[model samples]
Target: MAVGATPKIRLSLSEWGQMFIAFGALAWPMIKALFGNAPWRMFGSVEARRDYWRNVALVMIRTGGHWFSIRHLQFMMPNDRSACRLWGWMNWTSVISEQVDMTHGAGEDSAAKTERNPSIHWVGQSPQPVSTTGNNSQRSNVKVVLYIHGGGFVLPLSNGCITMMRTLLRETNDPSYGSPVYLALAEYTIAPYAEYPTQIRQCISILHRLSSRYGVDPSNLVLVGDSCGGSLCLSLLSQLLHPSPKLPQLPYTKGSSEPFAGVLLMSPWTSLATSAPSYTSNAGSDTLPPNVIRRFRDTYLPKSPDLSPTSTSGAYKRVDPMQVASLSGRYYDAVPDPPIKGLTDGAGATRHMDSFDAGNNKNDEWWKEIGSVAKRIMITTGEYECFRDDIVTFSNDLKHANDTSHGKASEIELLRDESFHAVLVSDFAFGIPPCTLAAKLSGWFLSVLRNPVV
Candidate 1:
C-alpha cells in the first residue's frame, strides 16, 4: 500500500483483535507480578535492578512496542488534531492552525506537491509582539520553547510529551528561574502518513511563523525534542546550517542568525543503524527491540527510486536518509573516540583532539558554525539505553566542534543517568517521582537563560 493510505474498516477490526491478543498474553505475567510470584531477577540484568513496579512497567511497555504494528499503535493513540483539541479544553492552553505557504521560497514545483496546514499547541497564553524600543523591552525576559515530539516518526503527539512540556513550563517560571516561559508544541505529519522533507517543512514553517509573525527573538527561542523528536531537532539544525538539496532554503527573520538560547535533547536517536555496541549490550535493558527499530527506520525512509547509473544526474539524485539521519556521522570524518569512563554527570570532559588535525578536518567550517543556531546544547541519555553509545559519541563531537571553533569551553553538556530510554518523559507519563536527571534538566534551562552567552 502507498504511504499514508487509510486502512479499510475490516483491516481496522482485525488490528483491534490482534491488539487484544497481544495484551491478553501479558495478563498472566501481570497477575503473577501483582501476587509477588514473578521475581524481578527473571526480567533481565538491567530490568532486575529497577524497582518492582518499574520492572513491571518496562515489561508492559516493551511488550506493547514489540507486539504492535505502527498502524495498530496509531489507531490506539490520539491523532494530532484530537490531541490539540483536548489540550485546548484544559486551562491555560490554546491551539492555532497556521497555513504554510510552500511557494514562499520553494519554487512552484516543490509547492505543488502537497497542501496541509500544521497546528501549534500553546501551554500558556499565546505570545504577542512586544515593543523593543526604549528600556521597556520584554523580549529578554520572555523565553519560548518550541518542542518537537517523538513517536518513532509514526505515532501522533503523545500525552507524555505534553506532560513533559507542561512540567518544563512550570519549572522555568519559578522565581529562581525568573523567566516567563511560553511553550509551543509543534504538530507534524508522521511516517506512513508522510516521508522525509514533509515533516521538516512543517517544522520550518512553524519556526518562521513564531519568529516573523509573533516577533519572537531567535536568541530567546529554545528548541527541544526527545527520541525521534531529537532526530528532527538535529535535522532542522542541519537544514539551517547546511541547506538540504531536497528542501527549500529557510527564510530567516531579523536577527535570525543569532544563536538560539539552548537546545535540550532527551535520549535522541542519533542514527537508525543498530550496529553500535550498546544495541547488543543494552538490548535487554532498553524498551525498543532491534527489529522494531528497523521497522520504523524502513517505514520513515523513502525507497530509492529506480534509475540507471547513467541517469542518476543531479536532477535525479535523492536525499540520502542514512546521511540525513546520522547527524554525528555527518559532523565528523571518523567515528569519535569512545566516551570517557565515569563521565555520566553533566560536566566538561577532556577533548580528544589527538586523533584529529584541526586544519585537515573537512567539517571544521561546519563545526565553527554551530553557534549560529544554538548557543548552548544539553543532551540527556540513559546509561542502559540502546542509543547511549551514539549519544555519547555525538556529544563529544559536538563539544569539540563548539570549543575548537568558538574558543568556548563547556558549550555542550551531557547527562547520563542509570535508567531506560526517554526516562524523563516516562517519569512524567507514569507519574514516577522526578529523578536527578530531571532536576538537572530544569537547572540547565534556568542557567542558560540567566547567564546568556553574549
Candidate 2:
C-alpha cells in the first residue's frame, strides 16, 4: 500500500471461491440453521409455533451449536412465566413484522388477505376520499400505523418477523400502552435490484397506495421501523421532507395517505451518514453471521449493473449504516450540478459505467455483484458481547438527529442494557421480566401507533 494511492487487492477465481468457501464454512450453519429461524408451519397451533424453534435451538445449542441470529438465540431464553410475560404481546405476526421491518404496513398490504379479525378496521380519515377496494363508509376514526421491516437489502417477507408484528399490534392496546393498537404494516424493496432511490420510492408508493384504500390521515399516520426498516422509515421521512428535483413527485393522491402522525423506532439506524460509538464497541455481540447487522457505507453509491459478471470496477457500492461516510455519501449523491452540463438525465449517471459489460457474455459482472451483495453488508462482530452499542448509538443518534435538524422533537426509546443485536428479541422467550423489558422499545412504537401524538 502506497500513501495517497489505493491498494489493489486482486485474487483469482479459485482464490475468491476459496475465500468465500472459508467464510461460508463459518457462515453456513449459522445462516441456514443458526442464522435464520424455522419457517412458519401451515397454520400451526400457537403452542406448536411457540415450542418448535425453541426446542430445535435448545437441542442444537446443547449439541455445540451457538446462537447467531435472533431466531436461533430464542432457544437460550427462559420460556418460563417471565418469558411468557415478556413475549405475551410479541407472539403475533404483527409484532414479528414490526420487529423485523418495523412497520405495520407490510401486514396491511392489499395483496395480502389477512384473517378477518374485524376487530381491526381502517382507522385513517383524510380530507379527500382514499381509493379502496372496500367501502370507506365502513371505516372508523381509529388510528393506523406506517411500519417498516428489516432485511439486509433483500429477503422480502423474511422469516420470524411475524411474531414481532403481532407483538406490536398487541402493544397498541396493552395495559402497558394504555390502549389497543391498530396499524397498517408496509414493506419496501431493497438495493442491487431496486437501486438507490427505489428503496425510498417503494415506501412512498405504499403510503400513497394506502391513502385511498386505508384512508390514512397524515397527522394520524404513526410511522415505525426496526433495524434497517427503522432507518428506512426515517430516511423515507427525511427524503419526503427534502425531495430532489431530479426525482419524481408523489403527492397526496387517491392512493397514498398523508404523512405520518408520529414516528417510532426500535434499534433504529436513523443517522445513515455517520457511525455511532457502538459500531466497533458492540460488534462482537451482534448475532449476524457475517456483516448482516450493520450497514456498509459504500453500498449507497450508484449501482447500475453491467452485463458481464467479472467487472470489479463496476461493483455495486453497498454501504454500512454504522459508518458516517455512507450517509454523507448520499448527500453528495444528491448534489445538484449546473444545468450547462450536457447531461441527458439527472443524478450524474453511475449507471452502465461497467468495469465489465452488461451485454451478453460469460457476464460474471452482474453475477459477481449479486454474489457480493450478500457478502458486503455490515458484518457486525467483535470479540466482546457488545450488541448494546448498535441500538444505543441508534437511539442516541435519533434524538440528536431530530435535535440538530428539527430541534430534537423526535421521541425514540431504547431498552436499557440489552444486547439488541442477537438476544434482544428473545427476552420474550425465557427472559426475566423476559420479553417485557425487551419488548418495551417495540411497545413504544405500538403506543405511538395506537395513540399518535398530534
Candidate 3:
C-alpha cells in the first residue's frame, strides 16, 4: 500500500454478513416485544385480540410472509383465508343478535329462531332475511349505510364493530335519517388469493347485487369502511369517477362502475407510496408498527424491495385505497403511450412511480371522473393512530378533489385524540382511558352517514 494512502475500516465478508444476521435477529424481537408487551397490546381481551390478530395476519401476508410462516401461524393462519382477511367479517357476531332483539322484539318462534341464528348466521353462505317492521307495499325514505368492518383483512366482525353496525342501522330509523334503514356491511374478499382488485371488485359486486334486492336508491347510499375497510371505501369511490376510464387499469376496481351517496372512513390506510409526516409523528403511538402496512403488500405484489427475496409479487400493486381523488385520474390521462394518465409510459408505469404528475391534470378531474359519487367523504380517527397523518393528507386531497370538481359533493369530519391504533375497539377492552372511544366512533360515523351536514 502507498505510504500516504488513507486506510479504510474494512471488515471481512464474513464479518459484514454476521452483522446483518445479528441485526435481523435482534431487531425482529425488539419489534415483537413492543407488540407482545402488556401495556402495548391493542387487543386486551378475547374480543379485541380476535380483531387484532386478523389485521396482524393480513398485514403479515402483505409483507411477503406466507400464511404458514413462523410469523403468521400463531393464530388460526390458514383455516380460512376469509377468516384471515382483516375486519368486516365476524369480529362481533353476538352483538347483532342482541341488537336485533333489543330493536325488534322476539316472539317465541322469532326468539327461538334468533337464538339459533345469532349474528354469525347473518354472515353465512345463505343469509336469512333480516327481520324489519317496514311493510313491502310502500317504502319510505330508507337510509342505507354501506358498513365496512376493519380487520387487517382477516378476522370477521367484532362485537364493537357489530354493535357499531347495529347502532347505525337503528339510528337511520331513530328520526335521525327520517327513514327505515337497510345496511350492507361489506364482507369483502381478503388477500393471499383474493388480493387487490378482488376485494374492491367484490365490494362493488355486493353493492350492485344488493341495491336491487334491498330497493336501495342509488342517491341515498352512504359508504363506511374502517382500517383496511377504509381502503376498500377509497377503492370503491375511485372506480365511480366521471368520464370513467375504460382503460388504465387499477386492480381495486378495474372494470366496475358503481357509486355511493357518501363515504365514512375510520383509521384508514391511505397512500402506500410516500413517507407522510405522521410516520414519525405517530410512530411510538402506533400499537402496530407502520411496517405492517408494507408487509401487507407481499400477499399479492411481486418481490419488491419492501418484501424479501423469498417473498412473492403479483401483477398488481396492493393498491392504495385513499390516494387523493385527484391522483386517481390515470384513466383520465390523454396520453396514449401511457394507458394510465399521469403515470410513466408503458408497462413499467403500472407499478412504478415515474411520470406521476397529478398537478398538470385539471382540478376535480378525478372528482369529476368519480362524478357524483360519495357526496360526503368523511373520516373519524384518533390522533394517536399511526394512520392519522395519511388520513389528514388524504382529507386535504378530498377537499382539493371537491374544489377541482367545483362540487359540494365532498366533505369530511374528524374525531381525533391521543387514542392508539383501532382505538374504537382496543380502548374498550384495554387502555386506562375509558373505552367509550369506539362508542363515540360509532356515533361519529352514524352522524356523518346520516348526512347531518352543517
Winner by lDDT: 1
Q: How far is each candidate from the true structure, as Cα RMSD in Å?
A: 9.1, 16.3, 16.2
Cα TM-score of candidate 2:
0.49
How do all the candidates rank in terms of TM-score, highest first? 1, 3, 2
TM-score of each model, in listed order: 0.76, 0.49, 0.56
Model 2, 336-392: lDDT tens per residue? 212212111111121111211323222222122211111011112122322334445
- C-alpha lDDT score of every prediction, in listed order: 0.63, 0.37, 0.44
Q: Which ten residues in a row have the lowest lDDT in candidate 1?
A: 346-355
Q: Can you rank all candidates by lDDT, best first?
A: 1, 3, 2
- Cα lDDT of model 3 overall? 0.44
lDDT of 1 at 214: 68
Residue 102, model 3: lDDT of 11
Looking at candidate 3, what is the lDDT of residue 407?
A: 36
Measured on C-alpha atoms, candidate 1 has an lDDT of 0.63
Which is the winner by lDDT between candidate 1 and candidate 2? Answer: 1
Per-residue lDDT for 179-215 in model 3, tens only?
4555554554344433334454455555544443344
